[model samples]
Target chain A: MGTIGDLGEFALIATLTRRLPQGPAVLLGPGDDAAVIGAPDGRVVATTDVLVEGRHFRRDWSGPYDIGRKAAAQNLADVVAMGARPTALLVGFAAPPATDVEWAERLYDGLAHECRAAGASVAGGDVVAAPEVTLAVTALGDLGGAPPLTRAGARPGDAVAVRGRLGFAAAGLALLAAGRDGPAELTEAHRRPRPPYAAGAEARAAGATALLDVSDGLVQDLGHIAAASGVRVDVESAAVPVPAVLGPDGLRHALTGGEDHAFAGTFPAGAVLPPSWTRIGTVTEGTGVRVDGREPPPGAWDHFPT
Target chain B: MGTIGDLGEFALIATLTRRLPQGPAVLLGPGDDAAVIGAPDGRVVATTDVLVEGRHFRRDWSGPYDIGRKAAAQNLADVVAMGARPTALLVGFAAPPATDVEWAERLYDGLAHECRAAGASVAGGDVVAAPEVTLAVTALGDLGGAPPLTRAGARPGDAVAVRGRLGFAAAGLALLAAGRDGPAELTEAHRRPRPPYAAGAEARAAGATALLDVSDGLVQDLGHIAAASGVRVDVESAAVPVPAVLGPDGLRHALTGGEDHAFAGTFPAGAVLPPSWTRIGTVTEGTGVRVDGREPPPGAWDHFPT
Candidate 1:
């Protein structure tokens, strides 16, 4: 296929939108100036995230497909963290005119695939020319009439739990930085996160009090919940799962590395959790995050680390 | 006075979001992973647009405030074109780390101001680092139980009407290009378009058959309605208003220049129109648009013009 410049904006949009499989939530899909989505519960949970070329993702390391999948996964995970079911996404893509049309198509395919996995659809999007590849995705979700599980809902006696592997993406990042080849799975995890999307709703159904997606490190992200709820959270490092691929520093990665996209929440003490969720710690009357007993090192990922 | 790099991401976010004025439509505002907006009508109209530095707006030409106002206005107009009341906006902004924090703050203030003008709120947003300043705004609106006024609704003999200025922004652009300083009003109009947001709902109330925001040139954009509705639209060139600053090229700009954000629609012949709407054209049994008696040149704005 020729470059996007040769195809022009309208033709490229036509080719990209032609076969997008929209779900029931999209009342009107991509052709119009705006999309109409059925928000059956009278409320829509919306969130947006932007990924820039060099800052968020390196094209040299991740393919267009991988980048797209990662972008969708991150935003979908955010909606899920609000205890909502993702219904649709609006993508704003900006790239140089000379960029390959095939690359753009593959990127969109990855977005469609990931949205399908979440039972959502690519409802609409805008495309524009920029100096670098950039993706700004806005995700919308329905609450299904359930009250959102906010970070402030964590109670002092709540049990902290988590779903999905921790630190696999971070380990993968470490491997990439060191120029070392990982066992294929760890490297793949780094490129595209497989967030347990269903776990958020499941946790809500099981009476989880507070929830958040673990985009930052586990302890670091849980700190947000602790601060919001005005309660203490203690993570039992031994209980935090470490994938074998992370090797000797697996525990460290599990504690402080980011981009795992895991689901973390708190539930009433002794509340039954679905098999996927494992109790990792407890909420108490305090002010911040602690590992077993003491405050953990502030090694979590900071976008603009001081 | 420091750069964004000095403030860091979280600190900057804290300063930016600490006092955002949120309207009642926002059920839950920022600080969470996602924002929840009340969609009382059981559905929502959603649209997104991305503006890149140098591509969409030049920093030297438009202030940060003007760019932000323009960005919010364009997206809000898209939602209005769907015959909905704008409720909230999600902004995803990416800028270089060296960018002045004050500029970012002013841009957000402009966004907040325009959203307030539409009776909407800044629900949530994301911030990231990119090589250039980029903004992706997603607007969400409620339809208030009204069916959307799509492009495919005009019928033969319907009278086409327009609300708001024609080619005003374009005239301003021309003046800016020529370096001939005109009225401050024209220069401001180029920097920030005052889209007739309320006119959309009024047109719907007036039984408009089709509606669209006049972003692209009048003929090019109206041609969309003609193609979708499979009808011919004939504009009375004499009836189209021209701002005096445009001089002789006023007619050309009225037909071919873009970025006006005017509301244009078609109503049944002889139907009573809202006071602000003016009959400018008539729909007939052919396809495409005509100015007076001939097809106008298709010299509309294209992001990647061939």
Candidate 2:
């Protein structure tokens, strides 16, 4: 109804946090000094990511609701990538004093809805004033007593498989950059990546050796697994799935696109994978990543050196 | 040695996270998708806070290192305020690409140092590009099997006590604003308020009826306790401590100053309190807070309406 400044700190906080759904794991929710989340495994998985205006997203292309969903999805994707079940989120929001209270509330609505989708809760957070809008989200998760699926566990003879959509966000981003809209799915993916939330535990149960989410494209992220596991990953381009809607750009997007939030992992070479997982590559005794037995060009998102 | 842009993302991340000391609770530290922190009590306490450039801090007044410590200290204090022992911190830092890589490294050093001071660790974090420096810090904690001390538990006739510092930071800010220095102790307190980390556990063990940290002045924070617990708090002016340097202004500063990170708690009447605590007030059968049975002026920090 009014600007954040008009509503004041206490009132603005009350409005944003009103009607939030706290999950079962949240022993103590918001409006406190801090929140208490149940770590059923006696261990907690935590990760944080910040999205800045203009740099990460443009307000013209994505609304506050989608921005909120994107922020929560990224951090939750990280927890799932670690083979943990999402439990709670703590958000640190900063915006100009002139920001409309309605925008902030809608953002919280998206945040709460996403947390519910992931089976987590919006527990606690802080609000501050800044020149530009910035959302810093921290997601906490439970491991259910299983060992974490670290990137250093893959062996040379492991089969590489991935679960969840690949390259759709990147393609969507390109469409947005070019001022093109419909194929709304791609652009929407850029805003809200549907991370395979259950895929993490499934991989763990299937005895995945090494695991990570594909945030910085398939090749770049898999390179991390290669470096950490001391092995080489060779992806067969033919085996990579590309949606027909993407057309000729599909191959390129599937291979080099970012913001997919897909899980890629290695399992025993002959082991059968969960149906959701698509076999795409193999881990071999070497270093670096290869596309169809050849080195792929350098590409992926970076924070600096533009 | 070079700017963050020159060093790029991976190298800069490596430099910032290198040689970081992780505590026993951290099963996995930086360089992973997420961190695994041991939740000794099977429940995790979490809180998040963000500091914006020029808003929360001034580059000329304090360097990156002190800013890092301040950010970590505030979030850690929130966890401790909930009667939990901090376990890990997840930092989301965004800075301009032109920022000095060494500056970022120094900032991380202070974060690590402060975490170690509080028996916690820098488990994991993220770095991104932004127009201005924004550091969002999230602290995770464990209860050690004790019940949390909430603000809603106080009852009339309970004795109130406070541990740690008060007013020094506010006084330091006044001096800084006047372009004065020396009284280095007070100025140092402004840069990094020493939170009584152990006092929270001490209060918990001693059966605190209600508890909270004074981040927004003594009266303002106590008002939260009063409102939530549905009781009045009458602070005895004579019992409040005043440093020698503060002179006549000491009493006013101690009552209205903010950022001391001190803890205030209520105990059953005549209950033995920890040695460090100073009995300052009493919970009363009424509404609102009063100083010597009179209302004090309105004063406290807020994010908006500036």
Local accuracy of candidate 1 as per-residue lDDT tens digits, A163-253? 9878898888888888976776787888999999998779988899999999878998899999999999999988998867789999998
Error of 2 at A155 (Å): 0.9
Each model's chain A TM-score: 0.98, 0.98
- Determine the iRMS, in angstroms, of model 2: 1.1
> Which digits, one per residue and each the tens of the lDDT, describe model 2 over residues A145-199?
8899988998988999999998899889999998898598898999888888988
- Docking outcome class, model 1: medium
Candidate 1 TM-score over all chains jointly: 0.98
Clashes of each: 0, 0
- Calculate candidate 2's fnat: 0.89
Looking at model 2, the pairs that clash are none
List DockQ, one per candidate, in order.
0.76, 0.83
RMSD of each: 1.3, 1.2
For model 1, residues B1-306, the per-residue Cα lDDT tens digits are 988878987888887886479999999999888999999999999999999998888898899999989999999999999999999999998888898989999999999999999989899999888789999999999999989888889999999999988887888888888886576667778899999889887898789999999988899889999988999999999888786876778898888877879988999987899888989989999999999979887678887643
lDDT of each: 0.90, 0.88
